[model samples]
Target: MPHEGEATPRISKVQDRGWAWVVLVATVLVQALTLGFPSCVGVFFKDLQYDFRASNSETSWFPSIMTAVLHAGGCESILVERFGCRVTVMLGGLLSGVGMVASAFSKSISQLYITAGFITGLGSCFSFQAGVTVLGYYFIRRRALANALASTGVSIGLTLWPLISQYLLDEMGWRNTFLIFGGVMLNCCVCGAVMRPVPDKPPGPTLKSCPEQSREGACLSNGSTSCHEEPLHPSKRAACFQTLQKYLAFDIFCKNKGYQIYTIGVSWMVIGFVLPLIYLVPYATLNGVEEHKAALLISIIGFINIFMRPMAGLLSGLSIFTGRRIYLFSMAAMLSGLSNLICAISSEYSVLVFYCIVYSVSMSVIGALIFQVLMDVVEMDRFSSALGLFTILESITILIGPPLAGLLVDLLGHYRYVFYASSFFMISAALFMGLSFCTMEAKNKLKETNKPPPETPSKGKYTEVPTELDHDRNGPPTVVYVTSI
Candidate 1:
């Protein structure tokens, strides 16, 4: 007899159709709700400043903490592994709702730091990671398209959130607006409701599969009752270590050069990537642009990205971009840096508006390809762990990006310098990643050409987990890659 959820096979055969579409839609909504809020923080920046009598650095802490906490990759990986994505997402939604509702009553920025920044951010972290993880599991043939589509939620969230925040602030002030945000955040639970788990590999005969483990009392005890819950201190430590190994990509960090380069490059890029989102509206407003128009600058980014991001995704899905997508992503980051530099030239209303459009064009590609590139670096089974580590590293940069910019503003007393700093970081990071990846590709190609052919033919199927990618019906054979336990 089959074990629970094992009667059916891995969803690969059934992926990209039927219930996968439902999961996709839910994932999109979840992504929008979580990722979109960070950028929207700009719309409320002034009111927060005026009401709390806080400095730019103090205000920066709120979003820095929120966005940082939201990328809790390590924590999220453990949660997704233990309880699965569904429970983790609903739990995040509930916590996020509480955070927002509590923020509405906060008497000080410090309290908002706890409630709005940490709690809500932690909630979003759970929802975003789990949603993205499930979406990956559900599609392979259309993986790029699905990711591109899901990523649009970020743009959608970006577009609608600012307008919503501004309108709500106008009608009922920030407190009531936050109260409403709490309600909006709760919808994550509804999205989580539909993310059914994909089936895992069917169980093998217990004794036949693991004689050594049984002998060591790992899965059995004295040929009687199981001893899964009770173990000695050392055994517990060993078990914990194994779980970390299996569920976290600590090993990948050390072994995979591609993963290491990707993680580091992305992490470094984030420091510059996040500054403009937090500071753009304030910079525009400070330079004498009207409040509503300043907000519109950000909205323009979302609007342009709505179109550009999908196109980027579709382009990535093609065979031509099979191995070249990373270069495209790098170019986008470089373009973003160039656009930030342009902002330093002038803060005129029309000039800032032009800057928004150009920045949006670059970021659309970045947003679509960022996580998708990570997916390319690591196989699916290891993706959760890889992403966990990736996010944790990037979150550090994100947590500090705004505050560092705020410090620059505080010290130099000019917003233009933030753009300069942003440009420096982005340009340098793009160059580093682009060059590093290009070198790796060239080395791999040279190695392939120099290697000799096999001396003898052998026939054996791969024992490790294999992902059956249905790229084409009559094209080449299925491409197989090893999946870690």
Candidate 2:
């Protein structure tokens, strides 16, 4: 319980202009250079296939490991907590740059997995996640818009990278193209340099008080934050969740049900989410499309999303959709599954173009909202840990997803089945998430409806009726107050 004279605490953030805008730009570019690279990886498919003499499943492992570790930044939260975003971001850039440079010189598929998959993904995790952490803190009034704009970097990266990779692959082949890519990846250092620290003092949003968090599933809301403003001395604290929270932050799973649901659902969703992007170019090539033209099919998706992402973000931020973020996301996920069925139907340029545009719109919404939704689930400032943990859970499926898709390709000897598999995963994930959230809401409402009314207190003190043991000894009604447990 709080002392009578203490004030409520605010989580500081929101410069909303000037340096905040610069940081936002940096966040976008960091995402572009790191997260966006994977989508264009398909451009190197044929060359890598020819050089390595690998089957589809073997080839698929490279990108699978790259993307899996990209989401598997288990240590990112600790880095951000101890070192701050700027240093973490810069360090990531350096690691990724080195990884790419090493990948250029690699002689085996296994070596590329180490250099490109693990190391580069590690570095990207650092730069991308840290930049986003700062971005979340910097805006409240325009969070949706800022996130939308920030996410366009992925679209932009996707749009430009495949085209650039194609041109480079033609001129210099995959190895030298990777050498240039290493240099390009070093640009993350510049973006990281822009991730200024979030302030600890507020002109920011106040933490809602304990009284409002009466719902059964509410996370971390039952607390007197101001009462515990001073830290507990180490000797006074027991070795428990507090100790775990200080180090691993895994205690958050126990605290936040939304985080649990979102993380698990998205993990399943990712099993199919990236398959379409990975196989799209190959599918087109096999269907009599020119190699360059097939690459353009990917480029078209990126281009449409460049426009679609911000619009989705803007539409979501409107008054009518203010509380509808999850519903919107679920709808988009379903759209992603349904749209892939179009590619299964035909690979003609026009049909593929139509598919790309639809996929782009769906992809745009998912990308724009992905992190935005995470930030909403966890408490502010603790985003780094929440996200770090999320990536760890998410990375498991990411690692297996593409290779699983490739195995399907190998077994069936047809690319269309990959889309069919993708459709099932995406659509099922959407239903699970949409229904789960709706069910949680209904349960909360029922709990609220049936809750007993609070008894009025007498003479400005909270009163609890004495139990059997206390009845004989008590002179007056017992006083109790809510505690930050």
Candidate 1 lDDT over 40-97, as tens digits, reads 8988887898899988888899999999898766677567655777888889899899
Local error of candidate 2 at 211, Å? 33
On the 0 to 100 scale, the lDDT of residue 146 in model 2 is 67
After superposition on all CA atoms, how large is the RMSD of candidate 2? 11.7
TM-score of each: 0.83, 0.78
Candidate number with greatest lDDT: 1
Query: Model 2 over residues 1-485: C-alpha lDDT tens digits?
Result: 23211212322222456678898888888888988898778988767877888888888999999888777765765576557678889999999999999999988888889998899989988887677666645554455456667777877888888889888988988999999989988999998877655433211224433233333322211110221233436554464555445434476666666667777889899899989889999898888998889888888988888898778766766667654577788899999999999989887889999999999889888876776556555554455456656667778888999888888888999999999999999999999988887787676556657986446422111111221223222111111110000
Q: Model 2, which residues run further than 4 Å from truth?
A: 1-14, 136-145, 194-258, 375-385, 447-485
